[model samples]
Target: MDNISARENRQARLKRMLAPTSAVFIGGASMIPAVDNCRARGFQGPIYVVNPRRSELAGIPCVPNIASLPEVPEVAFIAVPRENVVGVVGELSAIGVAGAICNSAGFSEMRGGEQAQRDLVAAAGEMPVIGPNCPGVANFADRSVFMMDFFGEHDQNGSVALISNGGSYLSDLGSSDRSLPVAYSVGLGNQAMITAADVLDVVLDDERIRAVNIYFESIRNSAALSAAALKAARKGIPVIAIKGGRTTAGQRATQSHTASLAGDDTVASALFKRLGFVQVSTHTEALETLKMLVHAPKVKGRRTAYATSSGTYAVLGSDIAEANGLDLQPPSAEAAAEIEKHLPPFVHAANPLDIVSSADDGKKTLDIYRAFLSGNLDVAVNVMCYPPEGGWDPTTWDTNTTMFAQAARERGLPAAFVNTMPEMISRSVRERMIAEGLVPLQGLEDGLRAVSNAIRSSELAEIVARKSDEEILLPLYSANVTNPIALDEASAKAELANVGISVPRSVVVKPDQATSFEDLTFPVVVKALSADLSHKSELGAVALSLGTSDEAWRAVCSMAENLKKTAPEIAVSDFLVEEMVKDGVGELLVGIRRVDGIGLALTIGIGGTQAELLRDTATILLPASRDTIAEALRSLKLYQMLDGWRGRRKGDVEAAVDTIQKFSQFAISNGERFVEAEINPVIVRPQGKGVVAVDAVMRLAR
Candidate 1:
């Protein structure tokens, strides 16, 4: 089937499973909770149970088997033994059931379970299946709960869809006290038939869903996910994600420095960034960020105003704001004067304005807040820590928060009510703040981080929306390669030069024939050339700065002798004589390689001998625009030197950008033939001198 038809079919099946009008349970007493939970959540649709041995379960009559069902149900929850899962799913599909949640275990997660998982997928052809080893999904919007584990009671008016690969984390999030507004929670275990992308696409169609949160160890379908994420970006919805298993142990062993620098995690981060997904490190940050996006007004930039009653909190807020890249500029002179009228004499008027004296009077507090928020600000934050509910009168806290919320709402700025500690704010206070159109964020650190993420996400969403589909979307490519061949440095440089990249003028001659350097300039670089030698400098196969022909010849003889003593088994038959780049201002590593799950990713960073030691780099998925390449260069730490640090001359940044662009295009054009390509120490000369690729390495599939 074509992509359009396949997507439509998947969507239709997911709609039924998520918002089922009728559901059937197929198992023994173990399926009682699912049936009862569905009924308890006010599922007004018909419910059926299929068990051969039992006559009834949870006060509901049980049918003998699939053949005895009254009619085809919209969805089913199967909890039979692992071996019978395929048979039951096949029976359901034959009768045209929309979808099913395969709750059976021992599929793909155990020894010899791979075949069972494959058979299960084949049997459920065209039917959307949630999992073979997962707890099912919960739709608070429609009150349809088909999960095997106990899910907590949630407010039916949630706007975030929580999808996770770990079933335990999904269950914990569903039952936790974080009070995240959730429209749907899904545990995508194994993803045999339905992938996370499939779920995202289906759920995003629900207009009630404002944002999405995903937690996964690996992406099952990257192209589909990219499409779905792009859809979300176009719709102005944020997709927050946390990628687990961020390790480099699985990186492909290659000859280029790019492989070691751009590991799986780094590539995944770049993919997420290009797709405009807000990536967070922890579950708390994810939850808090979702809350901010869902409840608070949209943050346009980082100009923020922090209000607190405690002077210490005000100071701390300034520190945190600076650390998180928030601009906490002081109010205008007139605004400061207006704020000073309401504050005590000792409480100075600043960005994190202390309004302790005015906290008692609602009108005074509102006056101060209105004046403070009227300045050039994108967001307003108030810090408050409420004492125990019964121990103290709640009148003062209520007045301050209410007036602050009102003032922020009047200015139409995103507002956050942060507590220094996570547990200091009572649930009632949080709900009250929410009712007043304010986000009650827990923990000062996490709250600010959430605000930063929200603002950045909004900015990224705009960028994604403005970009053409071809610029943002990665085309599908096969990452498989067989017996890759490594090209020697000279041949690699020649290949790059064919693609518009500048290379030093050079001639490759046999080591025995290195009798003269008449074709090259005086000061030259000589290197032992062989495809098998990746690190020539380490093997004493490279010589630099030869001022005369005799010097060049002597350097070549010394390299031959040194290599013969160091690496006797390898033969070095040729040497490349090249002119040295003297006016170069900086050196950079430009590399492009195929990331298995993701597409070709271009990594730009500090180059030369310290490339890996410095470890300063930025990666972007392929098909990147020149603007994107320039931005990546600016993000590097060495960009300071390239941009004329101190009194030094500026490097040819435009030429560097062009070189990166050409190399990226070459990689894309030859992606099928090459596995990895790298140009280390691309000597960027002074402005107008252009750039040169001095060293290069390439691995091609045989």
Candidate 2:
């Protein structure tokens, strides 16, 4: 089916799942709290309590079983034992129930339960089954609660929807004091039928939801999830996520909690970045960031202006902004003059104008902010500190910040409030800031980072939107190779030369046939070439700078004898004789690695022996355009050196870019024939000189 049809189907399923007019509670015990939460949250529909032993629950009439229900409920919450869950869910689906939340455990998460989980999913059919071991689902907007507990009586329905794999964390965040406006909260236990991606699509279809926050341990269907997230990102709906497993210990923990395979951390990070989702680490950061995005979110550029009531804060704010990638450039002469009118004589009129404490009543402070904002700054910040001790009157502070926010919103300028001491800012004051559409930031550094991230999210969202419709083709391996086989350097170099990439003048000669090298240039390299050996250098199988035929012959003979002593198990079949490449300004390592879920990632880094130690590399996901190649290269630390550091002559960066592009194409075309490929020390020469692949390696997939 096309995307629109799939989206519509999900939307229809979600409508029944989240805002069901009627529900049935299938199991006894701890499910009472779920039913009570639903009622308390204003679910006035007919609730059928199904229990074989009890005739009633909480003064409500109960049925004996699924077959005894008066009618099929639009939604059902199944808390039966593990063995009975699949049967109950199948019955629900047969009865034409639209959705069900299975809260039972021991499916896929327990040993030997994988098939059980698969059966549970198959039984649900097209109906969305939340989990077989999850906390349940809820929609605060419509007051259809089906979770273990609900404490959102104080919450106002807002834009952000949170979906989590671990039920406990979702409960904690749902009950926090941060006052985050939640539209829907779901605990995706095993994600049997509906995954994080499926839920994301459902929420994105709703105009009421402006953002989504996901806490997932594992991704079952990544392509669907990525497509949904990219779709949301293109529409300016920020999708923020905090993946659980990013380390070995953490991966094990996640696996124990929810039978999830937390793929490579590096690969996951690259995937998040490529899809334009803001990846956060801590819960505090996630809450604050969601709040910020819910408030004044979009900004066009990094240029920012701030007004502080204290001198120390002014200096600190400037440093914080600079560190966060914000430009605190001096305003135009006219704009500077306008700002000076409101500033006290002692305070210099600058990017971060320090309005003295004498103007604490907030009129002059507001005016200073207004002046900078009027000058077309992309973002404006108001720094407020030192709340009155016992005399902490919050009304005046609230009014002042609210007015400032209004002015900024009217002008379409992103605004933020920096509470230097978070403890000093009262909840009322924070609420006022949020209500007025201004980001309430806590600490100077944290606040600046939040603002910077907000701006970056907008930039990345634009990038996602720009490329949303473009299809990314992943590398598929060939089925002919049963086991991986490493290609000798001669064959690898020959393949490289066929793809418009330059390689050294080379020839393959056996030990018995190596008589004359007069046809080749001087200063040659001779090394053993064997498909069985991959790391030839480590085995003393390589010799460089053989300037004559006699030297080349002697080097090959010595290499053969050395290989015999070190590795008697292997045979030195032949030697590759090549002209030694020289005069390169820099060396680079370019390779392709297949990442789980995300596909091929082309890595380019500083080359030679220290390449692994330095790890100074950047990656470009496959199906990369020329622009992405250049951008990834420029992001590397090696790029500075390549671009003529310390007054050195500029290297052929453009030529390097061309080489990378051609190499990527070659990898894509021949990727199916091999499992992995690399070109080490692709010699980069001075300007106008082309690069050469000095050494290369390719291995067919096993």
Most accurate candidate by TM-score: 1
lDDT of 2 by residue, 305-344 (tens): 7777677887888887898798887777887787788766
Q: What is the lDDT of residue 2 in candidate 1?
A: 96
- Rate residue 695 of model 2 by lDDT: 81
**Candidate of highest lDDT:** 1
Instruction: Evaluate residue 596 in candidate 2 and report its C-alpha lDDT on the 0 to 100 scale.
Output: 45
Off by over 4 Å in 1: 110-115, 249-251, 509-516, 568-574
- The lDDT for every candidate, in the order shown, is 0.87, 0.76
Model 2 stretches with alpha carbons more than 4 Å out: 1-11, 149-156, 247-263, 330-346, 372-374, 385-391, 399-403, 406-412, 421-424, 471-500, 505-519, 528-539, 563-575, 644-655, 670-674, 686-689
Poorest lDDT segment (10 consecutive residues) of candidate 1: 246-255
